[model samples]
Target: MKERETWKNGKEFLFSCIGVSVGLGNIWRFPYICYRNGGGAFLVPYFLFLAMVGIPQLLLQFSYPQYSSSGPAKAWVCCPLFKGIGYAMILTNSAVAIYYNVIIAWTLYYLVNCFTLHLPWSSCDNIWNTENCYSRTYGLASMTGNTSSYNTSIPEDQNLKTNVTLSSNDSKTATEEFWTYNVLQLTDGIETMGTLRWQLLLCNFSVCVIVFLCVFKGIKLSGKIMYVAATVPYLFLTILLVRGLTLDGALMGLRYYFIPRWAELLRPSVWFDAASQVMYSLGFGTADHIILASHNKFHHNMYRDAMIVPVVDAFTSLFSGCVIFVTLGYMSSTFQLDIDKVVTDGPGIAFMVFPEALSTLPFSQIWSTLFFLTLLMVGLDSRIVQVQVLTGSLGDLCPGLFRSRVSWTSAGVCLVAFVLGVPFVYQGGMYVLQLVDWYIASVAFLLIVLLESSVLAWLYGSHRLSEDIAVMIGYPIPKFWQVFWRFITPCCILVVWVMGLVKHKPVTFGGQAYPAWSVGVGWIISLVPLMPLIGNIILTLLKHEGNTMQRLQKSIKPLPEWTKNLRSDQNSEQNGDILL
Candidate 1:
């Protein structure tokens, strides 16, 4: 493996963590999730999830580096039988990274087109019409998100006249709108795959260059660059928020954002969804933060940084919600269009929405530049971490890729990433991303986390971790956090996972639900890690040795603290013989 490159300080380390953790998901998805679930009201459930789960889990992932002194590989060893969880994480990270760059390419394409004031995907025809022309965003060639549903829902398919009014109580929507669109729903998944479809290819090419250059120096330079790179999106977001709020429809978007239907909270699924959103928004288990943690040198107050990263992340989500709704509202009110029709676009929205929004401003061109640039930066923000995670994961998988010091060259990484990514350039690429997201975030991440926490909090012991942190910091993690790590966090995910399965109705947003077999196949699509975990269990049992505990301990090389004072004390007599 390449020599480990540690961080200069917590500030730089935290910044890079922020760079990855607070990416497009927060800026794009959160606003819409908030808006959809009841704007300001969404915050209630969101904060609830964070308080009950996200915050503690964030602290747990951060605390993990300190404990393992390893990346995902080392981190997974914290659990007894779940040692292979790290490998699953690495796989998930790398897969996500490839498509993530595809998104950045989307943002860049729009940015370039902004100069021309020709936003692709503005009119539904851009998508409905499969054309060779650049003006129509989401060219047929670009296989971005869910083209199957998207293919079926072309603007031409929607018979509603432009600016048609159909609703009695604001439920009116474009003829073929996907799930729900609000400020958050509208722009979160901006169509980088839209008009000027060539931009997706071009943008990926540029990002591949940037990744190679930035990462070539390894984490040392990457961390320093992150100090600036991470903060740029917020700067742009602030400008957009200011201008967007001042425009028409901005307040309406904000109204949708802040006002929540209390009834939504009553649904058990709502809280479950909020929990997923927290995981998705915070970048909890994607191995993104672990890479950052690996680069960071240990500190006495690493816990403080741990706490701060999530707070900053959540804050960005909150502020970003305002920025988006304001912009969406302005777009909605200005075009004299129904807000719902404008909400749930693929590329048709991104190219059309913001360009259309900026058109209303005094210097629409300049604002267009900032807005696209900000979108690009927001898109860029997420892309970098995906790269970092991929690099880290690949380094784990193929140590030969960088056994010693290796050149972080622009050319090599670009070629490799592009070649790997080109398959995604095909029609089914977006479907793959959805499958990966479900498996990785919903399954691998949560499943591993549930297992990890169970071992740490139950078997390994949270008190020991508390003492370890306390001894290091001269104070312990608050009892609130302690309870969280031990119980609350895992239970919350466990519930979500269970409910997601038990009540797992395969309802489609637009099309007919897939048959049971297809849905079953979808579940297995990304559950790659389960095979290894189950295999390990079987192998351990087949040994005919002792119990799971004995077989696991036998396999692992002992650390110096094997019989450390942590375990052999209070609870030893009960689980002692079983464990040792």
Candidate 2:
């Protein structure tokens, strides 16, 4: 076998980390989480956790790949028993990559339609719009009790409560109808497969092609693409922020975002949300950090990279929140609605609310096009990292399969991802996306992180790991970081895990409960990645050449491939001091 490839330089690795760490979550999830928790008060816990838990955990994971010079799966070579963590990461990432592309396809679908002089989502005249479709002016007028009369012609069978009607007080906005009826063509529930969405399938195929071309040459081409991908989103964000601040009620939105409700600090859920957000936003436990750092030169300053990436991610989240809330503030003022009514998180904010707000702006088409394009770019950067994690890990494990023809291997991976994502293009696909997202992306992620920390800090020894990191970075490891990694961070993770389980609620979409079978399937998806870990333990006990205790100890021993020079140096230095 041949030697593995390292990043050409530190900048390429930094940009790649930025591309992976800063993702759609920062744009969509963080703002809403802030708004939902305690507005400005949420930042207290967020920053606290970022310092105590986020950066330390990130540094811990970051050091492994660079020190071992291997992907997440292979990075566990030191303690082969926990190697399942790497396999679990691969499984989790593969599942995420499949559904995540579906979102990119949705963004592409929206982006393509954004070119017209009259935005499709701005008017209620389309086939998807119902009799109840209302403009911002109409909504504001309705809120003020000066509602205009309009024809309400509808069949009794279609007179459902959820259906928006002109006669009803609650009417659906054009953008809402566009997202639900036009873009998604969503079914009533997950039980129905409905029909394939041809448009979305085409977009998904296009996304696959774009991803393949960008990374087909591996990091050589991808590293250069990272320069554009990592930096362009900020430019787009700055433009949106300038435009958003100029809108009426922009101050009110900012007030809602930063003005803390001090009482919320007492709530445990707020603290939990803050901790969870740090983990999610920082890309910890996803193994993307490990895989990306693995490509860095052996002596690169990953300690510095870890610190820089999380700070950049937090800044991006704050910047994105400002941009989003400014638009939402305008939406609220235009409709004479409260900020809470106008604000939403996840796909609702990105696909529905933001687009609705954009329709009312001057040069609506231009702004709308830019907004969706921004989404496409952010999603594209994240998707590239996810693809890299899978391909990189596989390349590490099976060199023969990928080494001779890296481009072919990459194309094959993209094709498989596209095929796996097809079910999400069906009318009921959104439900599948929601199910997988809720189960795999939340508690499962934290559990994986907790296990990884335990194995590394306790089993592998944080002191030894610190010595390795110090040697690589040419600096002494901070005392606080050592304490955080060995104790504080793990305790914090356990608390968050327990809190999440206590507050766990059944997954729902549009306030509708999922069928039991679908929920069962979701749980199954969550456990699938964990299967390897369980199997590895059982096999270690059964197959190893020793008694139970001895076999268990043997399983955790460092592999011969783990770098031994640093540990040997530490030992030699100690012996030399004793001799003196």
Candidate 3:
């Protein structure tokens, strides 16, 4: 067997874990989610779901690797039947890594444009702008946010509107136009991929190159890089917060962002959103954490690191929300628009909203550069770790083939991911990106996470695993945590998963639902991760020589090898010394 790699120090492991958790979503998605779900009131459910689902799953991700001495895909020695859970994680994360870089490409394209004396997206003067393109000023005169508006709250309504909608009658904002026409050069639908946007292709290639360099060798170098990669976004966010708070109407935006809507707590969707946000924020289901944490030493204190990473991830979301709302408020005040007109989530907040909002500032070029750079860093942080997860898992799964060939494995993964991402640079690629993201990252992800918890807490025995963690970390896992892992967490996940399926709507982009053929394609994409699990089940039943109950008992039984390292570490701890 090949020797597994370890981090030089715990800090690299911590930063890499942070990078995995905090990504583009923290900056562009969370603030809007919080605002829409009831602002300050949303935290109640968010943290509740975090405690119930996020933290328990996270501890498992961190501890499991140390227990097995393996990466995610190879860590299923205790229950080979559920080894598919690990493969499913790699598959889903690989699919995510493909389109995710396209987003980084978009950010890079905008970053390059930021060198201009005038912001390109700030007006309707570009060749890409059609007659329907309207600047922010077009509907500013009549816009208001009051009770008369639908879903309007003076400090509560996140989707506020007025007589003149921000984009209506087939109109688009300058920023929206730039995003659609210039940045994306979007086609009518997924059916018409239109032509390749060479500029975007170049940007995507650049991102692939950056990722390849950072992680090609292994975590030894990548771990050092993460020290800077993980923390630099915070610095930029702090700077933006200072500037945003000083802007006119910043207080109003903050008010709209943070004020509690007590009634929203009564709605089920708010809780759902909170739970989903926690999952999204920490990447509970992805196995990125498990793969990353596998690089830590056996005796490393993952419990402390796990808690720190999640707190930092949550804090970063709140901090980024403050900065986003501050600038959004400034935009609202300056343009006489409602807060709802300015608020948006997902890629829209970063691409359509912030570009325009930053353009209104004095040093538009500098601020634009700063903001996009921040996007680049955060996106890179997440992507590099994702790449590491893929490469490392492959090495662990096929050590005989890849143990000594890390660079080749990393190159192969990056090249394939880049090739897969080529379609996203096409004019119609945004539709495909959204479709893949909606299915692959949504329902299938939830299911994979659910399976992981069920397999560990029930099949492998949560109590035994907790004792293993105690041997490694020098503390027994709390009873509540075991309860959560065994009972509460699984129930909550099942409920949320059911709710998600029940509330499922056909995926749509802009205002148009995808064509039937494309929606069919989406369902196929959603099923990609589950294939491994199903196959493993059939193989387990077929290969294990026994009746149904006997086969089940044998499959869940831990292999003697699983105890080899655990016993060694326990012995070391029982003595006067522990392995460093």
Please identify which of the two predictions, 1 or 3, would achieve the higher TM-score against the true structure. Answer: 3
Candidate closer to the true structure by TM-score (higher is better), 2 or 3: 3
For all predicted structures, in order, the TM-scores are 0.78, 0.92, 0.93
lDDT of 2: 0.83
lDDT of 3 by residue, 259-364 (tens): 9999999999999888888888898767789888888888899988877888898889999999999999999999888888889888899998988999988998
Clashes of 1: 16
lDDT of 3 at 374: 94
Shift in Å, residue 342, candidate 2: 0.3
What do the candidate models score in CA lDDT, each in turn? 0.60, 0.83, 0.85
Candidate structures ordered by lDDT, highest first: 3, 2, 1
Please report the TM-score between candidate 1 and the true structure.
Answer: 0.78
Worst 10 residues of 2 by lDDT: 145-154
Question: What lDDT would candidate 3 get against the real structure?
Answer: 0.85
Candidate 2's TM-score: 0.92
lDDT of 1 by residue, 32-76 (tens): 666667556667878888878777776667665654446776555
Ranking by TM-score: 3, 2, 1
Predicted model with the maximum TM-score: 3
Most accurate candidate by lDDT: 3
Tens-digit per-residue lDDT, 134-222, candidate 2 = 77755422332222211132223332232333465656787887887678767768887677889999999999999999989888889
